[model samples]
Target chain A: MEQSMKPDGMEPRTSSLLDWFTSTIGRILISLFVPFVTFIVLWQGFLFLRDSEAPKLVIALVAIVWGVGGVAILYVVSNWLIEQLPSQWVRRLQPFVFVGPAVAILAWYLAIPTIRTFWISLFNADSSQFVGIQNYLDIFTKRFMIEAFRNNLLWMVIGTSFSVSLGLLIAVLADRSKFESIGKSLIFLPMAISFVGAGIIWNFIYEVRQAGDPQIGLLNAIWVGLGGQPQAWTALLQPWNNLFLILIMVWLQTGYGMVLFSAAIKGIPGELLEAARVDGANEIQIFFKIMIPYIMGTIITVSTTMVIFTLKIFDVVLVMTGGQFGTEVIATQFYRQYFSNRNFGLGSAIAVVLLIAVIPVMVYNLRQFSKQETF
Target chain B: MDKKIGSAKRQSRIRDFIVNGALLLICLIWTIPTLGLLVSSFRSRDDIATSGWWTIFPHREWVMTEKIVPPPADQQDRDQPMTFAGVTGTFEELREGVEQDGKRVVWIGNKRLGTVEVQEYKWITNANFTLENYENVLSGKRYQIVQGDGSVKEEQGDDLSGAFLNSLTVTIPATVIPILIAAFAAYGFAWMKFPGRKILFTLVVALLVVPLQIALVPILRDYVKLDLNGTFLAIWLAHTGFGLPLATYLLYNYISSLPRDILESAFIDGASHFTIFHSLILPLSVPALASFAIFQFLWVWNDYLVALIFVGSKPNVQVLTMRLADMVGSRGADWHLLTAGAFVSMILPLTVFFSLQRYFVRGMMAGSVKG
Candidate 1:
């Protein structure tokens, strides 16, 4: 083994693989870097293509040159810089290549749009006049808007937990079963239906009929057949209607949760399961004691996804009842204020509130994702 | 020992059957409503009103009351002695001969026409049952139904040409535009490198939190400024913008996951990033691109809000969901018509989904979940 080393007494094979990632490929990129950057780098590249009324040829040229240069140059620069630095820096440096595009998009779209939204929230309806913090104050003061806040909280708690728990339960039960494929597909079918499509379908189910007349809505129809009065399902003025709306979210999201949970379950090591079985543990014990703890990170991930989804609940409410009858959620309230009322101040305040509610969940998810990517 | 092992095998077999059976039942329960809706969408609204979707299988009775009017002698059918309910008469006596081919005659219930002679067999399904609704719809009889407090107002809804054109306007570009933007971005994100990459990724991932509703007001305001509001362009842009994050994210995962060795070798072969992207990346990403295209296409097809806001309530600018909304509201009580409208709207999405859904699943989590 010692004789296999170079005359310089260094590991020649290790050096070459390092050399492949660095110099040979690195030189082409470094040489191409100038031409690439000069050609590709431009102002607001995506938006420019969008705004250009120019012919397709011009747009194509512009986009290609800019993109090619940026990618090739960045690769060369990042690789060359990493080679120059100590080995300790390489691990930390690799994430940039993966994450760079997402950051630029966020800066242009989200960061700018969000800050602008906040600024507009401070202004009047058309975004012309300044009205500092007044919109925020109005949300706290207004009754319907306050109800919207409460309803959002309810959606967040009930929707996220239900989607996660039921999904987990079903996933655990369905794992390795003969019907697993069918069971998951049936549930997952809802995931494909857009919020608007699902709402339209549900409309028939929740459709109400006159007491003596035949029931048309599947749900109310069933209720009537079972001898109950055909109640206006969404017209219930109490907490019941909110739960009914929440059920739509649960129905739509349970499939998403199930998919995630099934993946998590599949990820559990077979040896651990075998070890638990060998200990004479029953099926329930093996699952709860061994499997659940092992996939806890995945459980957190699925729930966090639910949290983000619930925080932005909109379409079901908009389509079903226009968020009327006390089913007003944050997103619906935002739409109604901004679009319907054209009350920019109030709308921005609601958006700000929603943004605030979502940040912690996002931070937690990012941390978890980065944690996984590293370890 | 042999007996115990055999007994254990028998017990496990029993457990398997019980477990499998329970799972099938659970799947059935979850799927029943969608199945019911699909069935109901195909059913006549009256049938939906009258019975459960499950009732479609059995013998069922429908109470139908229709009026009859005798046709001019020139309009009379030459086939046979048209008698209804054992009452034989001419144009002077019998009150039914269905209106066909611009000739007016009343429809007798097929069951009633068969047993109860209306003096002629002129009125029945197909020739009369249809084209009348289309005629009525074309003539703006859509606004004819005014039930309770008149909560829904009809705004000169789609006459055939109008609705058909409106639907085309909304769907075509809404589908085409997003794929264009998403493909480019997905390629760039997947293959290109830049600064602040992961954080930007985190941001886009975080954007999954930004609901479409959150941006509606602001985006609409921008569109209004650009004078693009109420144009097909606005709706197209809205759908494209909203659909891109996921499209790019999904495509990035897939494109990035392509064997780096392949891309590096292509680079060595003097393949420009564009050539590599257009040829190798695009071809391989067909599955991912197909799935996202299906998703965005279906999403744009089914989207109601972006259509409503960007396209406005103009009758000619409406998409299917908006038109369906209008149709459902105007013909609110006529579920048969509503079901028809729903099925019409659902047709494209379902066709697109069944054809491309495998891709939606694969493209969605391709890089995220390592097999």
Candidate 2:
């Protein structure tokens, strides 16, 4: 009691309720709430419009216009109005108004879907009624979904590994080289092409030509010319085809890795490199001993990023094999379940599975950005 | 000073060689696929069907082929040396096929004449070459040859003349609307004293985590209810929705890094928020705005998912991506034509990237590192 009283009638100077509400904690609430409220009203509005004489298509188009338009107006007005206040007050509350519309939209679009998807996972494919964990259980029990899950593991382990390693190697090799810019640009060029486009490009390279049909596809024609019967590379089934798909991701993601890691590699002090040379270390030794440690943070950053990206990869599998022929990744699988199969629960469950798989890496990545690694 | 500079310059030349050589190699690799795509796009389906681009050099040569109609086999290989007049014999021919094996003819004039027959007859001019594939693709016959799948063959736009305009309609406004709004917001956030600025920024950043798929259904429901489901307007709104988070995030990062003093002085000098935004913020943020513009423009341009949901896949309304996908999904197998069609779709994106790419200022990364 005496100790408490001596502290000027305050309780150990914990954050004030007002301050708590105004700061980090309260703002996150805005992140969560604004999107929710916006969505509920939009859904309700859509329902209300259901009875109107308006055509369903036109009604939806208008609501979409309004939702999007409202977000734009809110973004401009709130930000401008907030800027008028004093700095200290603005600093405390500015983030809310500035980001509120965006967060609301994100929620309206992403957050609500996320929550509904989670709920949908508990329901049947049509999302009409509840089904509980049966959909999730089906992931393990069903043959096709299981194979898809297995393929996703392959994507996560192999695709991420190759992308990270290749990217890192390219980043290191390209850095400070005479052709660094050219090498990097070349490596980066694949990224400029869409995954869909890349699929089309590679399709030609991997194209098969039947005996009479002059092989339009370079790959199959080359194969046939080399004395092997032409084979559809994408239809090669598992093991090999999986590697084929992974190659595409590596081709695309290597550029991303190189950009991030190259910057990190540059961040290493020139002094350390000089010291390694003075110590009679060979170039290889210096790279492994001195250089690797210096860029380890960057490497971690890059690898974790690749891991997250690998987890979310949908387009590659979708375009390449349509997630069939043993190339199904988790994200593609989610789309397959939800839309193609019309099974919302399974799709949501798949989404959840991916989200769960990525959380650890996401946390780890965010941590690396903030927490300095010890030498 | 001159001597030191000269020595350094000479040393740098050696380094330049290595750099330039490497860059050249990189550029070659980058360009090769694009080159492949472009060349592939123009190639005849028959040419594509038979050989690789590497063969183009040899394939381009005119192979003079001399030939005569042989008697029906029922009439028997006309016995005895049927003269140039009776045998309807044809002379030797040059060709691009691998069967020629450097010089050996796979299908020479009648066997009765043998090697000597080469001198016997005249060549049919320009008989082997064709632009039929190009015509077919442009004329839309490419669907049968390039896309094997009857159900899924991508319909080449009735020159897609209308869809092209529709795509532009969806893309430009989608891009413009977001950039305009984001510019204003960015200036306000950077210069004005707003309540909850930090928190608002943090929330916006957090929005990055919310995946788009989650909102697809609900958004559709909302759109349908609002009677906006099947128009360019819906696509515009959808593009803006998806584009805003990234646009604001990027613009905010750029604007916040502007010299605070310049903005402050303007504020004190009786400049309204609008005035400061118009005069100073807008002028200086060219790089940021350009980069975001590139992003928004390219995204709205290439986006498939939003267009698919809002506009539906009706032939008249479909975009290039959908059409191309139809070509692939249906053809079970027509890669050559697919490559060509893909190139057409890629042209706009590539041009956009190249022309506006200068705006992707490296200094933005400088801010990311520091801030």
Candidate 3:
């Protein structure tokens, strides 16, 4: 028992129930119990405030206090309780105290819901009956689902490639230039805008009017300037319109890739480039033989991230086309199935399919994380 | 050797020119769409409809617009005097009046120019910019309705003020709460030791890519059952959950890498884990905390998906992105309002982004590279 105890020699030699209560094990259980009860009470208070008929501003104020202040107090109180325990018990129980709320929240919110969604995927439309594999079958059979799959493929391939390559290109060019910061800042600005805002901003560029009418849209104005007829870029074209929508995402995400790649490029040892140049490698050869090989890990990281983003691309399509003209992607299809069509089974199945699609990249990412020994 | 040095210098100069020119063009391409939206938002609706936003600079142009209308049934004769558009004159005299006045005019044409056709020409200069769009959006459009007694009554119109408040209410707590929670968790994952730590943390990492759609249905159903739907608390909790993985991951990278000797010395000096964390770790982790704070702030502020499903469509509780989207759907052709609304939604994020950009970039780089 002493061997298991901390070497700090702070343990009290006692065995009675009340004395045990002050012992390490007793204090550990008490610490956990106190925080749990306090959390419950705080949760009840939050619920009371939420359902209360109080004014919104008052509720908002109370909530800020409760949210920010309550979290701080909870941490302080829990950590203080853990401190009251003997050193060994504190060591064993303290990690839980620190990581428990986060792990519990993750389990409750993300982990549990993910499992529940998978279960719902096997059930019928309202989740009233178990209809296994039928919804999954429909994902492959439905025309809209097929289109969504096709578009998602296009988004994953085209969007990810363009964003990554363009990001790499710009990062390489602006690596040490005088205007690097300003240029990257300008390019990076769109990443700050929400996808919905990006859709509207791009709409002005893609806006079309009658050929003879002065084109208010920048794209059509330029098109008309070049003697081409002003065409509805997003609407009048089939298959190609998907590319138009994809461009908005590329615009928003390229900066993310550029910033990441720029960091990775900056990490490449200057001596490597200098040696390559001394060995008669030109800029192009240096980029390919040296820089690209150097940042391959970052490239994969960025590509996998973009792949996941493009697979679940929703806001842009929903805002721009509302999934019209065969522009439906998987997330939009799931939204349509559940929200509009009221087909919970189909929607959950679609969501699960998206989950499955991301699993490969996710597993790849975990391997990378483990490879980096982040833990 | 002199000639060779000169040629090499010329080659490098040309390379520099190409590089600068390419980036300049790329920046222009990136900025022009947003610039168009910004410029278009300031112009009057008529001006926006008639010409491109690019026409606002250089020399203002005089544009002549012609509208043809059928002559009134009572005035079909070639020489009949006509009253139209507050002008009264015969066909021949109206032409003379138009030439003399050189203002907008309504001219009834003679038989050769089609007797039944009346031509109205207006020469308007495109040289106007106004803050009316922003005023209309921010202050909410107010309309004066003239009653039968000719008294004007002002009525309220839809603006973004309420939605703006709701977004703030959702964002502030959501951004803040996650940071505290994740910071504590990160400190544990970094410094503290317990069983199942590795597996538990791997679970969090694996969750980083779980599409939020998987959680939406079950959470929505639970919220409905709990009667927590459409409340700020509901969204706060939802965003907290969704945002935790990245937060933990990023903060873990920072907190774990802190020089171990400091923490070890603190422990040897009889500081408890809690005290050390509060005093030493918290202060040291501000950079990481700040990085994650900006990340969560921008995300919560700009989010539309989680807000739409969780916050629901109640007008008072709607967010800026939701309101902006609704404007796009309902007022699809209303470019002025849409542009202004989009700008409004973008302003806060853009400001936050530009102000704390270094931390933001540091956060992004750290997040991708995993330290």
Candidate 4:
């Protein structure tokens, strides 16, 4: 036993078969038994709770206790099981107890599903027959797909640029202003609102009424007040309606950009800006040269996030316009194809296209992350 | 020298004015949309439909028609006070209620002898604000239609309250599970020595950008196969899976940056990783944990698509966002209910944001900029 513990500097020591239960490999294998049973028990409990006709309040209470307590018990029991093994095996098996569930979940949820989606994209509708490249061909040549691509591009360009730039502008202006916190809070307020809520909120702003009716919608009221025809901003406008939809995202996301840029701006050493100013840099010059370049990392990070977000924009479009009037983005297209048309193949293909479009940004982000090596 | 100093001070003053003005304008633009909804939620149905929410001020006169059945002659005194609906007033006051208090009050009802008419009385009044929208929305009673027999039937509303509870049921476990799981994984990535650590960690990082849409179809199929669709468990697991990557990424950054000496010293004291994590690392990571908790809480609480796909708009299980989305789709003309419902869904996230804003902002900064 003593020799087994001294593997730190000693060669491998043989043990009896009975003693094998306490050996490193033996304990590692034994550690799996407890968690496996616990998982089965919890799964059964979850299934029971799901199918049970109990009162909702009772179910909810039981679930909260069971779900949360179940995870806690799982960890404690598994850790206890590992600790009962020889000290040498404890070290070998502990990491699994820590990282195993997360890795398993991520693989099941994201990594594996992504590959599955690609495979499904290669098949026909209902996934019965293989139709390689046919779905992709439709995505490229179909009118709706083309509209979605164009709108997504517009969202990527206009939405990202507006959110980031407006955020940067506000961050700069409110850097040390007395109203800095207030302004930032107001802008960031929308970020807390669900996209569905924001869609409705903006719907009030974009609502159109009959020509003689009182314009309850603020935008229409303003338009009619200015002697223009009361227009259906989200339905009638061709390309501009897309901008109207994009505005909700910009409104929701600008605060995100602002908060990040503000933090990054504050990170700029005061002495650097003071030095630049002392050397006779004007405000615009200081902004362009020192401020922009100083927070350029943050700018890129925010821009990349905004770009990715805009690419996947769905809820606002789904709620506000239902992808009508030239507001069809890739995500809404995927929704229509998969859920509405029941064309899983085309939906999967459209989703894959979206994923492909985002790959460059993801790769660039990875490079930036690795370069910083913040971890 | 005096002139130079004076001009510099004036230029600085002008700059301050411009900055303040610009920020004020921007904040106004940002807040007006939400403010419009907030105001509209308090106005009566006719007011919301006929006039803008902005007209709530200036004490707009509303034509409120109430069908009043005159009280029996025995119950018309000040003690009993004639009452219709919820309004109570003496017979004399109710008959000729021309003006009371500062608001102009006018009651139009035909009085025969000492009794008020049983017909409808339209009150031209200045009391514009009403809590009926919130009441109706929260209570799930859309309208009360008077039948030909004079019986009132209360139609069911969107049941936002039930959905609100369901949202809580989904959000709490979803938020808590991911944080706990991610925290452990983060500790492993931060401190543990293991094979494939680098590759596994990079895999998690790459997953941060995987659009959740890609997982929907397969997962939906799997849920159908497993008979997990429309269950709280289904949506909870879906959210956990969707939220794990960022949770791990954020927690890893925070846990990895913890002072190495503390963990090293704990290890030297014969503390196992589990013990050290529970006793020391967990306490030290509160700020990180809090930020990520808020992040996950808000994300899961405000989620629509995941809940919609997994939970399936079954009224009993639908979350607030789904119910609100459904209302917007079906009740396009019911801005009164829509505005109130939208506010109901927003209440929790807004409260979390306003109160825990520091941690929330820190989380966002770490989530985006630190990456």
Question: For candidate 3, lDDT tens digit of each residue in A34-141?
Answer: 888888878876886666777667766777777777778887887778667667787788789889999998998889998999999999999999999999999999
Worst 10 residues of 2 chain A by lDDT: A1-10
* Off by more than 4 A, model 3: A1-58, A81-88, A275-280, A369-375, B60-127, B144-156, B368-371
True contacts kept of 2: 0.22
lDDT of 1 by residue, B1-371 (tens): 99999998998898888777777776876777677666665554345556656656543332234334444336556244554433444433233543323333333334233222222223332111232233433343455534356665554434543454445555655555545455555555555554544555566566655555556666766777887666554665566567656666676666767777777777667554445666887788777777666666666666676777787865545556776666655666655455555555566666666666677666544432100
**Candidate 2, lDDT over the whole model:** 0.62
**Model 2 stretches with alpha carbons more than 4 Å out:** A1-100, A211-213, A361-375, B1-31, B59-158, B180-199, B331-336, B361-371
Provide the TM-score for each candidate, comma-separated. Answer: 0.70, 0.73, 0.86, 0.85
TM-score of 3: 0.86
Across A1-375, the per-residue lDDT of candidate 4 in tens digits comes to 000111121224566775654675666666777778888989888887867888777777777777777877888998889676666687788789999999998998889989999999999989999999999999999998889889989999999999999999999889958999988999999989999999999998888899978899999999998999999888875887888888999999999989888988899999999998999999999999998998898898788888888888888999998887788889889989999899999999988887887788668757866786544
Window of ten residues with lowest summed lDDT in model 2 chain B: B93-102
DockQ pick, better of 1 and 4: 4
Clashing pairs in 4: none
State which candidate has the highest DockQ: 3
Docking class of 4: acceptable
Candidates arranged by DockQ, highest first: 3, 4, 2, 1
Q: Kindly list the interface RMSD, in angstroms, of each predicted candidate in the order they appear.
A: 8.7, 9.2, 3.5, 4.2
What 10-residue stretch in candidate 4 chain A is worst by lDDT? A1-10
Ten contiguous residues minimizing lDDT sum, candidate 1 chain A = A1-10
